[model samples]
Target: MRLLRVELSRFFSRRAVAMLLLAAALLTALVAGTTIWGTRPVDAAEQARAEARVQAITSSPEYKRDLANCQESPEDLFGPGADAADCRRLLAPSTADVVGRVPLALADEVDDSGIAVIVIVTVLMIVAGTTFAGADWASGSMSNQMLFEPRRQRVWWAKAGAALVGTGVAAAVLIAAFWVALYLVADARGIGTGAAVQTDIRWMVARGVSLAALAGFGGYALTMLLRHTVGTLAVLFVYAAGGEALISLLPVERSGQYSPAENVFAWIRDGGRVFDSSIDCPVSSAGCDQTFQLTLLHGGAYLAVLVLLVTVVSAVLFQRRDIP
Candidate 1:
């Protein structure tokens, strides 16, 4: 109990945590306000204007020419002509097709911009968790802690548990606040209580929480193994940024499933494409050809195994290593 309190105090005492929490709150507010309050509700006037614009563009000679070129291209159909046809076919779909495919209500409810803020917050929280355990050892605080509690393993476990719990609480509070704020804004905007909004918000929040928890546990494990803040942070940044980008660019499709970050993203997307505007598979593609498919259960299992392995390793190290 004493160890848990001490760990919590140390975590909250850091200025970085406070600043991160504040920034997350502010960004959440901005996203909710802009998405729910700023945009006008879609009505007959808007629909008519959109229809008229679509008609005007599709009726244009350029659009007709491109469509004809695509139809005539052998690339889309057969040989050398197929290449030219394929190029022409890359043009945007007809406005009518786009409209037919779009879910205007879902589009209105979704704040795609919120995704950036959520990712940033998750990364920051992971950093905080990674440093929480290893920083004590690096700074010689572990010596004092061990002196007070002779069971080094216990002390390490307590610290890990405390960091996990603290981070989880902070994440939950921020998300809950954001949810309420968004709901209020949505109500004010007269968006109406619809199944789509309800479903999307529920899924987003649930997945966001799971992602944060996974990040927290993973960060803790990495820091425990590395034991140096700079090294751990560097590795985390590489994995979070460069590693994922490289994985995405790989020519081989199956290679992606093995990449940790890609799996995490797949988990977040819940088997769907990450963005509505982007198609996971190209036009005429039969199905999603992801290198890896991650279910929530799979992600949970991976995280659990990682957390258990790191905790065991760290405990052993704590028992065997000399206090600095």
Candidate 2:
């Protein structure tokens, strides 16, 4: 307990951690402010005017003709496999979109914001964890500390505890602020703040918090094994950003489902259909079709397994390896 306390105090005192937390807050505010600016609230009269214009445009002969032409056009002329996104874009009511007077903030927008927060906070946690472990070695402080404590695993546990606590606290605060800002924007924009919205909020909050915490812990474990900061961040970025994209190009079934990003997103989105999946038709599809890689519960369980594996491996290596 004393060791943990010491670690926590030190963790909180670090300038890097402080900077990371501040950056997270500022970025959240910036995003919220920008969102609110772009979707600023409109009076009923303005909404009516916008809707009227939208109706006129959609009902216009030109738009209707273009819509028809796009639907009936050949795929070879449009470049290839054009039967997917064309009609959906053309037919979706512009007035009902983000700039439109949509009643409720869509589930997808909430998921998008949640994913952004998770990515931001998750990387911070990983960097914090790596620096927490790597700094002592870099500064030649670990040997001196070991002279007093001697037990390397105990030291590792204390640092890990401190990392989790710091990250948990940071993530909770950041996510809460972002969610609040989101609803404020929603409410001000006259988007429905109804039961369904609240339910999505609840779902996102639960999954976002859990995902951030778990990913942070995983980051901590990886840093402990690597014992450096640069390599850890590089590997994490590749895993988080590039891993899924590279894998997605493969013509493999369910390719998107099993990636780290998709699995976490599966839980974040509550197992709803995800992005970059197939569309019903490129231009003239009658209906949209979608599928989930994993159910909500399964995605959660898979992530838990991943975090556990990283943690166990780190602990084993920490116990066996001589402190550098």
Candidate 3:
């Protein structure tokens, strides 16, 4: 407990970690601000201008000619069972379509801006974890710290615990603040979110927090194993980018199932679909289908296995390997 407390202090005290956390917070705020600004309620003047534009378009001679043509043979324009009313309704552009300033919708944001913020935070946390661990090795402080606490495993775990806990708490706070700010804006604008949508948002936040924390933990473990910041980052980059491409070359069916990005998004979104072109269709090209459903369980399990393998190997190696 004492060692963990000390390591936790070190984790927070690091300059890189502090900057990364600040960056995450700034990014969250930026995303929230952008979403709110982009989706601000359409003003009266804007609405009137949009209505005028629509009226102008509908009143044009070209529009009249097209409408008349469509009314003559609605089946040619909109397939069978269409009429003059259908032409009038479908041909005219609405004010909303012209204005294009949609009101803030929390449910839609969950799938769009919410995922973006989560991804940003997760990437920053990964860097935070890597730098925190890498600093000790780079400065040759790990050897000195071991002298005070000779048990290597205890020291390793204390550092790991600090990295995990600190990153997890920071992620939770940032992600929650993001949603809370947006929710308040939505409330002030009189845009109500249903109980079901709120529930979904909460669950998504929970999953996002977990994924970010684990990503940080994985970064720390990988750095510990490699003992160099750039080496760990390079490995992660290759695995993230090259691994997906390599998997595609394999003859395995549903090769996208092995992609880290796919599983990560699936875990964050609760579930997702993957399309693999490598899947050999049994019949003609017309009969080919490549899309496959990826469940939350599969994503969770895949991520857990990856983190577990890296952590176990890192811990085992740190126990026996010489630290410089």
Candidate 4:
């Protein structure tokens, strides 16, 4: 318990961690402010110009080419090998009318903008966790800490507990603040804050916190295993940013589920009526019209396995290798 407390104190003592927390809070507040500000009505002329731009894009030569290709390869283009209604919506002539909106509803605002908070929180937690653990190694302070308490595994557990507690507290607070701000904005914008909307907000907050904690755990485990904070960060950024191309290289159909990036979204969207179709044809050339095919339990299990494997490896390394 003393070691854990010391670890937590060391974590909070870092200026970078404080800055990261500050940055996360400021950015979340900015998101809320922008979301509220976004509700302000646009001028008629501006709305007209936006509608015209959509009309132009829908009718553009490039869009026509894609539509022609989609018609030729509808299944390959979207999913189920053909008849992707959602995909077809994009190519349809009525898309311009579909794109134009006079008033954004409260539900729509939450659905559209709440995703940003999830993304920001998850990524922030991952980076913070990595640096939180990796900083000790980066500073060559792990050896000195171990001189005080030589049990590497104990140190590891302490660091993880500290990381998780930090992530959980931050996630809960930010998610609450974000939704509360959104709710107030929705009410002010003349949108009804109905029971259904509130229910959705509650669910979103729960998922956001879960994802953030998962990211933090994974980040800490990976950094501890490698003992190379910069390398861990680089790999994460690449996976988060360029994982799609790598996912494409996989020959398996519905291979998107194999990617952590996609599964994170799947975990967030699990059991929601967000996807138009749930059927996935991974064995067939027809695409999975489904949103992410993995269930929340499966995604959580997969992520847990990943973090567990890395943590086990990290523990072994910490025990066998000298801290440099």
Candidate number of the best TM-score: 3
Model 4, position 77: C-alpha lDDT score = 64
Highest lDDT against the true fold, candidate: 3
Q: How good is model 1 by TM-score?
A: 0.69
lDDT of 4 by residue, 1-324 (tens): 887788778777778777877788988998888766655566777767777777787778898788777877788867784574655575664523534434546577565667788888878888888889889989898888889888878988999988887877888899888888767766776777789777877887898897888788788888998887788999888876788677766765566666676567666765332232323456766654555446777667767787788888977887898777
Compose the digit string of candidate 1's lDDT tens values, residues 118-186.
566577678778767667757877788777899876777677777677677777777666666666655
| Candidate number with the higher TM-score (1 or 2) | 2
Predictions in order: lDDT? 0.65, 0.73, 0.93, 0.76
TM-score to true structure, per model: 0.69, 0.74, 0.97, 0.74
What TM-score does candidate 3 reach? 0.97
- Which of the two candidates, 1 or 4, achieves a greater TM-score against the reference? 4
> Which is the better candidate, 1 or 3, if ranked by TM-score?
3
2 against 4, candidate with superior lDDT: 4
Please provide, for model 3 over 122-194, each residue's C-alpha lDDT reduced to its tens digit, 9 standing for 90 to 100: 9998999999999999999999998999999999899999989989999999999999999999999999999
- Give the range of the ten consecutive residues with the poorest summed lDDT in model 1: 271-280
lDDT of 2 by residue, 78-167 (tens): 667777366647464765462453343645458555677766876676677677766776677877888889887898889888888877
In candidate 3, residue 66 scores what lDDT? 94
Worst 10 residues of 3 by lDDT: 280-289
Inter-residue clash pairs, candidate 4: 75-81, 75-82, 81-286
